[model samples]
Target: MLRTTEQKRKYIQATRSQNYQASLKLEGITTTAQTTQQSKAEILQKYKKYSQPES
Candidate 1:
């Protein structure tokens, strides 16, 4: 069975949000351990870039 366009959009949105949230949580833990702003920014930036939809 094939999914509709709206279904695909919803799926992508849900996945992106989940990935973003998970990454944020990971960043929090890592920051607590190391206390480095640069590293945290790098990690979160990488995650967001990787999770972004390909054009």
Candidate 2:
């Protein structure tokens, strides 16, 4: 089944949050500010790549 745009966005957000949380947990860091910031940047880059309009 195909996912709607909202579903896709939610999925991405959830996955990114999960990954950041896991990273922080594995590193035994209580604060994930830096990691979360970096993850957001990476996620934006990926979205930009895939969301670019076709020529």
Candidate 3:
């Protein structure tokens, strides 16, 4: 019973470390991805001088 408990603890720690590493890598990727995706309000502001006709 003690051995199993220890194994479970190690397994959890290993998985948590792996997840943390993956998240660290993804943080960089997400930051760049987010910058590339422009919001509608920002797009409008960029061309604010030219107004779009009503639909």
Highest lDDT: give the candidate number.
2
Better of 2 and 3 by TM-score: 2
Q: How many residue pairs clash in each candidate at the backbone level?
A: 0, 0, 0
| Candidate 3 colliding pairs, count | 0
Residue lDDT tens for model 2, 1-55 = 5379998888889899888888988988786355434577888898899999999
TM-score of 1: 0.48
Mark the 10 consecutive residues where model 3 has the least summed lDDT: 28-37
User: TM-score for all predictions?
Assistant: 0.48, 0.49, 0.45
- lDDT, candidate 1, residue 12? 89
- In model 1, pairs of residues that clash are none
Clashing pairs in 2: none
**C-alpha positional error of residue 11 in candidate 1 after TM-score superposition, expressed in Å:** 0.3
Q: Listing every candidate in turn, what is its Cα RMSD in Å to the true structure after a full C-alpha superposition?
A: 13.7, 11.6, 12.1
TM-score of model 2 vs. true structure = 0.49
Top model number, TM-score: 2
